[model samples]
Target chain A: MEYFFELLLSGLTRGSIYALIALGYTMVYGIIQLINFAHGEVYMIGAFTALIVASILTMLGWNEIAILFIASVVAVVYSMAYGYTLEKVAYKPLRHAPRLSALISAIGMSLFLQNYVLLAQTSDFMPFPSLIPDLEILEPIAHLITTPEIAIILTTAIVMVLLTFMIKFTRVGKAMRATSQDREMAMLVGVDVNRVISITFIVGSATAALGGVLIASHVGQINFYIGFIAGIKAFVAAVLGGIGSMPGAVLGSLVLGCAEAFFTGFVSSDYEDVFAFIILVVILIFRPAGILGRSDISKV
Target chain B: MLELKNIKTFYGNIQALKDVSIEISEGEIITLIGANGAGKSTTLMSICGIVPPRSGEILFMGKPIQDMAPNNIVSLGICQVPEGRRIFPFLTVAENLDMGAFLRKDKDEIKRDIEYIYELFPILAERRNQAGGTLSGGEQQMLAISRALMAKPRLLLMDEPSLGLAPLIVKQIFEIIKKINTENKTTIFLVEQNANMALKVAHRGYVMETGRVSMSDTAANLLANDEVRKAYLGI
Candidate 1:
């Protein structure tokens, strides 16, 4: 029972990170119907940006909490800038082009960003400073839950709740939903679809950056290639949840995370990636629209 | 308040509108009526900048608007209730209406306008909280029109508001269109395949065929024309 509980806690923490990254995938897909392959690179950039910030703050002798806050804020801002630039340079020009062409452009962007970062920073793994203070109050459940795990879960919950509120209550959020449904119709009714698309990239990138920062802190290390694997896993989660559905992304991530944790905990950890792919294939075969995705019928 | 001269539009190599010219004064209900593939929708789309004219000019309040973006044109006070009642399916009726007023910043005015919309279409008021996709065809059309009106547009462009509805619903929609034109004093540019309803309500009409306006006259004269009767009125 204790072992099961431990696995569940770890799964939730991992799932929270996946959910944050998956949201970027799901939202961009919802609005533009383009799978932004470079989104993973944005996450990678975020981790490195945080690392750089942490090093600077540590040199300045800042407290751990202040260092974490400043590092996260700077990382999120840098990632947002990268996301915006990526969209403008790589994706915007190809907006009206064929889907395959846009996809090729995205993959090209992914490679460009990876190489750029690799040349700028070292290709080797860098140690991520542990900034989350260990909470001694949870000593009773310390075996099952750690401070970092609690922080990851709480941050995800807060972000999700805030995101939901924004989507449901805000004007820009309404415009985004309207644009996703029908771009031309949204334009006819006065939505600047371009602006909405830009905002989507901004919000999505910020969340993904948050995930990158948190995951780096929890794992205590990151590399230039970390985003590629994490990005693919989150893409799997997004598709599992139903590509365009926000709640579906989170649900899918949790399910995938739990499956991964259990597979590694009970079975051979080496087969984790294999199990994740198998689950994706099986789910797609049965429910192509995903767990919560509605199969849309194109109206004549 | 709106003028188009020798406007031409194309979809790739296929020309959808050729030499289409129109002129409308403020507060007049001018309708473009035609059969399927006659470019009536294209004419409206051109004005909205969804499909910009490759040639000629469009002026709104005498300011050249052909080069503007769709949202910019909308912000200039022209709003479209598009064909097929393209209300956001996932949004509640109220949210759909709120989206229509997206560019407007005055909250109290928006609230009052929403109240006015409820008065205009009582059925929409009742289903305000329901998702727009679930509404009946007639109700959806009403919501589309209401959504456009929420923008407080000076010029309202309506495309096939009566499409896919029962005769009774069509009649109800036409009545509302007329009421909006007269009571609100809003200039309307309507496009419809249903010439019978469109001609009856509009002050003037243009007949389109094969991407060009074949005829233009006062509504009563167009309705009386033998060629229009044979081709469009099904007489």
Candidate 2:
């Protein structure tokens, strides 16, 4: 029973991180109907940004908590810039082109950003300092969960609550809902569709950056290739819940995370990824539209 | 209120409107009647700056607006109720009305306009919280028109409001269109396949064939013209 609780806690931490990354995937897909394959590259860039900022702050003898917050803020700003430019250069011109063309451009972009980072920084793994402070109060259950894991779960919950509030009550959120359903009509009603698209990219990139920074601190090292694997996993989560549904993405991530954690703890760790894919395939065969995804009911 | 001089619009290399000259005075209800693929919607879209004319001038209230963005055109008090009554399906009826007033700044005025809309279409008020997709076709049409009215436009452009509705519903909508024009004195640019219903309300009309305006006259004269009656009115 103790072992079971430990595995569940770890799975929750992992699920939270996946939720952060999966949101970007789901939102971009929701608004533009593009998979945004370079999303992983954005996460990689965020991690790299945080590392560089933290190193500078540490050299300046800043407090550890201060370094964490400042580094995260800088990383978010940089990732937003990258996301904005990525949409303009890679996707904007192809807005009217075939979906395949935009998709290919995304692939090319993912490769380009990876290589750019590889050349600028080394391809070798870099050690990352733990940014989340150890909470003395939770020391009673220290065996079951770590401070970094607690930090991740708490942060994800806050982010989700804020995101849900924004989507449900804000004016921009209303425009986003309208634009997603019928873009031309949105234009007719005076929505600046291009601006909405930019905002979506910015918001999505911010969440991915938060995920990147948090995971780097938890894992103790990053080679950036981590983004590709983590990104693929999150994409799987988004698909599991329903590609375009926000709540679906988080639910899917939690389920996937728990499934992997249990399989690794009880069975062999080597088959963790294999087991995840098998679950996805089995679920898809039965529910192609995903757990919460409404099958397309396009009206003529 | 608006003028299109020698306007030529193209979708890629294929022309949709060619040399489409038109003049609309303030407070007049003008309509363009044509068959499918005859460039009627394209003309409205071009005027609204969704598709800007390639090489010509579109002057709204004597200001050159040929190169403005869609939102900018909308800010100039030109709002469109596009073809198919393309309401956002996921949005509730009330939210759809709010979206129509997206560019407006006056909160009090917006609220008042919404109330007016509710009064104008009591059925829409009843379905205010319902998702637009769940509404029947006639109900959606009412919501679409009300959504446009929320913008408080001096000129309203309606595309095929009568396209797919029962005759009784169509009559109700046409009556509302007439009421809107007279009550607000808004200049209207109506595009429709239902020529008979349109001409009865329009002060003047243009007949578009292929991509050109083949004829232009008073609405009553066009209704009586043998050529228009046979080809369009089915008289």
Chain A structural similarity (TM-score) per candidate?
0.99, 0.98
Q: Which digits, one per residue and each the tens of the lDDT, describe model 2 over residues B1-235?
A: 8999999999999999889999999999999999999999999999888888998899999999989889889999999999888888888999999999999999999999999998888998899999999999999999999999999999999999998899999999999999999999888999999999999999999999999999999999999999999999998
Mark the regions of model 2 whose C-alpha exceeds 4 Å error after superposition. Answer: none
Using DockQ, give the best candidate's number: 1
Mind giving the per-residue lDDT tens digits that candidate 1 earns over A75-181? 99999999998899988999988999989999999998899988998799999999898988978888889998999999999999999999888888998899998
Candidate 2 per-residue lDDT, tens place, A1-300, comes to: 999999998998999989999999998998999999999889889999999999998899999899999989999999999999999999999999999999999999998999889888878999988998888998998999999899999999999999888887898998888888888888888999999999999999999999999999999898858888888888888999999899999999999998899999999899998988887898789887788887766764
Off by more than 4 A, model 1: none
How well does each candidate superpose onto the true structure, as a TM-score?
Answer: 0.98, 0.98
Computed on C-alphas against the true complex, the DockQ of each candidate is: 0.81, 0.81
Candidate models: Cα lDDT each:
0.93, 0.92
